[model samples]
Target: MLSVRSAAVRAQCPSCGTWSSRVQSSYRRTASDLPLSGRAASLAERVRRFHCDGAQRTRRIFAERHGEEILAPFARRTGRLEIVVHHLGLALGGGPGAGFARRLQVPVSNDTLIRVVRRRATAKAYAPPRAVGIDDFAFRRNCRYGTIVVDLENRGS
Candidate 1:
């Protein structure tokens, strides 16, 4: 089982540019991931509420970080599980992705995977391009070809 421990650390307040030690609060969250060898990987993180001594009178609760990882800010599974799900999602497609997760004893819905794929596709479609250059490529071997519009402003195709 994953357990969270409070540690002393300095954090910057988003409301004000004041740096101070974050105070621990009675808040905790645990996220589970796909099991490994009949055991599941879980993350236990502590949440803290901080008091800022800046000009603004505000208090903020910040999630503690473990090493190079940030928790609570975004929902995520374990590193290994994430890798497996990503690869399976890409290889098996969205429909089979959810099935793969079920086989692994991980709770994942098909709609979630579909939504993820759609969002990714939309993001890629509207991605910005760095350099813009026109190049001619054959659409079909020797049948059709057209000039591709390359956006040079953002380095995206």
Candidate 2:
């Protein structure tokens, strides 16, 4: 367990983009961090809620922005911890990755690991075949016919 706080005197409002030093209230947020010395580790941060002073009718009160590079809003785990989990899910898959994460003192479910993989997936663009080669073959005395398509550019089927 580790306790910390942001040293910045003021934080910029995410909605209005105005820097505010007026602190409305403060709260503590906990997030799971990487293991330390083979033991589970956690970080407790004292977050401050600021009153937006911008003229724009945006949010009245907003919490201090903990940059996404460190931890995302409402995230239960640190950014680095999530990265490790993402890699584990990609390498070992859901079931095995969850088991490995448990061995590393990271508490995560197999379903969560699977969700992480799905959430991070990106759609790949499909390209039309540039050069195609089509051929027909007879299985037995022209009784059965089969067609084979190959990409002539890459020389692959």
Q: Who wins the lDDT comparison?
A: 2
Residues 72-145, candidate 1: write the lDDT tens digits.
Answer: 35656554455555566666877788887787776667776665556546756665566679999999999799
Cα-based TM-score, every candidate: 0.61, 0.75
> What is candidate 1's local distance difference test score?
0.64
TM-score of 2: 0.75
RMSD of candidates 1 onward, in order: 4.8, 8.3
> What do the candidate models score in CA lDDT, each in turn?
0.64, 0.86
What's the residue-level lDDT of 114 in candidate 2?
85
Model 2 steric clash pairs = none
Deviation of model 2 at 138, angstroms: 31
Instruction: Tell me how candidate 2 scores on lDDT.
Output: 0.86
lDDT digits (tens) for residues 35-103 of candidate 2? 999999998878999999999948989999777657788988888888888889999999999999999
